[model samples]
Target: MLMLTLLGWLGGYLITTQLIFPPPPPPGDLFEVPDIRGGGLASARERLTGAGLVLGEIDSLLHPSVPEALIIGQSPLPGQVLRPESQVRVTVSLGPQLRSVPDVSGLAEDRAQIVLESSGFLVSVDTARADLPRGRVLEVFPRPDAILPLPARIRMVVSTGPALVAMPLVLGLDREEALILLDSVGLIVSEITEVFRFGRDQGVVVEQEPASDIELERGAKVRLKVGMSGRATEQ
Candidate 1:
């Protein structure tokens, strides 16, 4: 009778333990998703596998701050309960979008600035003395057709026409000295007239067409009359 009672008690204990209080599921069957954003693609894949999850479809897009091939986004956000071997979709970065600098040379300054700004570039203008018309774009830094990341700063050189300067006094000076003085002031001597004069005035500049203190564009031509002991000659 005691043996029968012992056997019945053991049977009841087994049923309660097996049915009433079932054991927890195996650790491998569930997982809490891990955060893999900002990690490299290869490393993210390894991380997902280690967490009992698998990498799913990968999409890529141009991201300004995120580096190329790095994970920028993921589905099944971190700390979510997921079944083992569940797939996690990710979006990878292709880095900042590259842009080709457009040809803005010869365009007006305002137009060039608009074009650059429209193309996702920052614009800065610098005035320079050029042969082109005033306010025209002479050139651009990084040159045309150069490729760079978006939002890059571009420096444009715009024409203010030719530079102007006051003509220097060359009268009564030696011809060579007069030439040097004119050159120093950004003036070019285009014509020279040789005139017969007294011995004291020989080899000296007697007159200049534009006179002194006249404002003229840089590289503007000036006519000079020089004294000579020989017969007067035109050159």
Candidate 2:
């Protein structure tokens, strides 16, 4: 009877401890951490779960090349062994940083370039004819206050001063004709002087201050000397 009772007690204890409620694994047992970099957060979590690990603290930061929400760094790096169910911390990318374009219009070319470069932008210079002084910035592409990714290429339109036009021949023509020609060529007749002359030269242009074919800016002032048969007067 005593032997049977002892056997029954041992059987009950085995069933309760070994079968119904099992003990925890030995402390020395560990699992190898899997590589989870360059992957999305969800996928990294799934990978960690499969490797008998748990996802821990998640951090994020702006990256120039990595896509948003993708893992960029991992703790307990790949191939490192750790206790099963260990927490693995990770850092994900928030994508590239954004920057606002600065106002550089009316600034000197060198200064404009400096401002743009200081703001982390690439600059390209192009020239255009404008009333502004040469080497001054006339405008900027994408305008001011525009938001774009960092290291974006910017194009600046710089002024090369006003456009130049060749002076037209006005001597030997009648006053009316000279006026018409100058007006058509964007030249303004600032002053006219009348001189007494004889024969066919009467009432006609005899001389000009800036003789023909001289390069001048549009809307430049021109002085003319016209011939009058009976009067010497300034107009």
Candidate 3:
């Protein structure tokens, strides 16, 4: 009877010991951290999860050489033993830092574009006719000395040179002569209609469209009315 009792006690002791304290895990059972630097946050998290590990707190900072949201560094680097309940901490990049817009007014288009791009800005060009020479920057949006985020798009207004020209008089002249006169001043003949008048000779221009010396755009069209003799019979 005593032998049976002692056997029961030994079995109970073994069961209690196992319940109280677990055996240490084998070395190979631990997770080895993977190199995740330069990888995106989503991918890093996936990699950690795949290795039987958890992702820890993340830190962010501006980094010129690293892309945004990518892992720039990590705590407990790759190949380290990852404890079962431990997490991998990472530092992520937030891309280039912010900077102010420089004074690019009066600079040529190509030079301005290069300057802004080098300063980490995107560039857009708009053109307007101004007294400034063609291809010269007339204005910069957001203005100079304005604080802006990195890679901000800057729209520059460039000059397209002068646009206005004076209209020339071409009245009482032959049709071919009128065409030649208009062509010399960058103007085109839009229409040539005939009008009958007592004093004017046939095929001569009696009136001009935009009469003389009026400011207009170069290449504007001018209409003319030629004189037709009243004595002429209809065909």
**Per-model lDDT:** 0.90, 0.91, 0.83
Please write out the lDDT profile of model 1 over residues 1-235, one tens digit for every residue: 9999999999999999889997887675679899999998899999999999999999999987788999999998998979889999999999999999999999999999999999999998899987788899999999999998987999999999887899888899999999999899889899999887756688899989898998988889999998985755757
Model 2 residue pairs with clashes: none
Model 3 stretches astray by more than 4 angstroms: 1-25, 28-81, 84-89, 92-96, 170-235
How big is the RMSD of model 2?
12.4
Candidate 2 accuracy as lDDT: 0.91
TM-score of each: 0.59, 0.66, 0.43
Candidate 1, clashing residue pairs?
Answer: none
Lowest summed lDDT across 10 adjacent residues in model 3 is found at 226-235
Q: Write the per-residue lDDT of candidate 3 for residues 1-235, one digit (tens) a residue.
A: 9999999999888887777775775666688999999999899988898988888999999986677888999999999996675799999999878788889888899999899899888889999997677899988888987877776889889988658778877787886788898898788788877777776668787888898999866667888888875534222
Residue pairs clashing in model 3 are none
Candidate 2 minimal-lDDT segment of 10 residues: 226-235
Worst 10 residues of 1 by lDDT: 226-235
